[model samples]
Target: MHSSTLFITLTTALGLVSAAPTDKTYNPTKTSAASRTTHTVIAGRGGRLIFDPDNVVAEVGSIVEFHFNPLNHSVVESSFDTPCQPKDADSFFSGFFPVREGQSDEVFQIEVKDTRPIWFYCAQNNNAHCQSGMTGVINQNFDRQEFSLRAHKELAAEVEGPSGVQGGIQGGWRIPNPNPLGGF
Candidate 1:
């Protein structure tokens, strides 16, 4: 059962990753032709990618991406702001589950029309990163939506967490490294 979930997760990742890291900047997104690709962020490697720009607006054929940092997480396109519990098994998100961690899963190329509102969250308890607001937008195209995202921050205000974790940083239960690595 574990391997099966991993397989489905890997299949979902390949569907989002783009060719290369497009222009990494704010105020102005990549206008190049290859910008159609996107990176779907997930848990693993480290923490996770927070809303650096906090929010972004994309056109019809824009490609976004999500990468794993130093945390164990997944970008499940379903609902439930929690983790593992997939609820968007409908037509759009069904069979489109891609998650990666510890290693590269797959690349997910955006194939939606305009305004793709994908809600992703980390399924890590004891750390409860998502409950602490670890979500962002890919190629969302709307003014009102940007304003709506503001709630994600307050959404976790009641969450008993964030002792040593930063806002954009990942916060989840993890085993301490027995061996100390020289460098990060």
Candidate 2:
């Protein structure tokens, strides 16, 4: 009888131990990467007239939120080789979001598809904007210092016009006065 009771107790204990959850079974961070994440970027700020962080590294499921300042500005996708010209296929334009004084705010959100590097510039009416080195990059493979040097050296011509391809912003994203008479 004693031997039987001891065996039963040992078997129950073993069953409970085997059913217990393991410490490594659940990892929030591993699964959280696919969860949506928002990253903010200033189109132009502090009178410097540049993307606050001209270079960014975004994961596959991240969103890049661009906030335009008081100054008239726009975000248009371009390529590294052709820094100024818009690559029609991969192009996205945020039109020219002019926030009036005392107005709320407008943001352009772009979702990341992959690790491919994305280059953009301000395609304002005045060509000087892009020429003045108003360019930004996302998911950049190279270092920030190296990307900036390349942006300054490469960005020469301004885009002929915005490609009229509006991307980055999902359907839920609303823009105040979205379709201006002659804007993207």
Candidate 3:
């Protein structure tokens, strides 16, 4: 009876341990070179920063490309603080810059590694670009709500000068006044 009870307890403990979830952080340091997929997101297509297809799906370590807008834009990690962490496909090309009129910062590419819901935003307006609903996501379960939140949050932070150059009412994010616009 004692031996049986001990075995049962040990089995239960092991079961519980295996069921526990692991902790994953939004890391922007380490980079892994995996098979890449050129996922292009076009900006300034219809007077808005749009990701065309709206939905992008890829395996881990794929290289996602974000074609910037002629409206002058930047990329950043989806967060309220505009961390400018760059959540595209890879973390190696992390940066924040203002593209010239009718120009962009080249093909923004990064690697999607972790299977976490990565977010991003435009580092221009008061997240005007993002707040205006110009945001996107990678990995994790995504539909609509999740994309808006993650994209806008990071855009907000980016606009706050992720590169120290605020739009200041000129070439910034086109924030739809009065309300936030979706499908951007």
Candidate 4:
């Protein structure tokens, strides 16, 4: 009887241990590269002076890749207060991509460092591209009605001239287009 009771107790303890739930907590800091999402934003697609999906909501560790279309265009970081201008020296800029025939062979990729709204615009001023509503935002907080892409565009429209850094910055990578031929 004593041996049976001991065996039953051991079996019950084992069962309880097996029934415990496993830990599946999500930690953003430890996210793997494979788990990160890459969002594609087409710049000047079909000769239009606009970013296809002008606004995107990206999380930390995610990537925003900009593919430049024909007639020369660029991506430059800017602030909400001063739209159509470079935010600061540390801001990211993809040098002008002059694609005359087809999409450029290179693509600008920037990783989302935080959840803050990142505003950007094309530096081309031929016909006032930035002022023509060539602006976009990432992770814009819709709750803040005062600060939005629409407001940014309004401010950009008021700016006399939109400018960018002299060259590319360190926050992003200008890599060869993964699908140059527009393939999957």
Kindly list the per-residue Cα lDDT of model 4 for residues 107-133, writing each as its tens digit.
999999989999999988642889899
Candidate 2 lDDT, tens digit per residue, 56-164?
Answer: 8888878887777766777878777666666575477776777654222667777888898888877664556777778778877765555553654364454444333
Candidate 3 weakest lDDT stretch, 10 residues: 171-180
Candidate 3 per-residue lDDT over residues 1-184, each given as its tens digit = 6998888798897885354566976669989865556565665555576555445676776766655545666655543334433432322322343544443534566667767666555555544565555555666364555445454544443454333322232211332121112222
**Judged by lDDT, which candidate is best?**
4
Cα-based lDDT at residue 121, candidate 4: 91
Lowest summed lDDT over 10 consecutive residues: which window, candidate 1?
A: 164-173
Q: Candidate 2, which segments miss by more than 4 Å at Cα?
A: 1-34, 102-104, 143-153, 157-184
Candidate 4's TM-score: 0.78
Tens digit per residue, CA lDDT, model 1, 71-181: 344443423232223334331221222333243333223344556565444445533655566554444446664335555445543446422222222211122222223
Error of 3 at 33 (Å): 9.6
Q: Which ten residues in a row have the lowest lDDT in candidate 2?
A: 175-184
TM-scores, in order shown? 0.43, 0.63, 0.49, 0.78
The better candidate by lDDT, 2 or 3, is: 2
Model 2 superposed RMSD (Cα): 8.7
Give each prediction's root-mean-square deviation over alpha carbons: 22.1, 8.7, 17.1, 7.1
lDDT of 1: 0.41
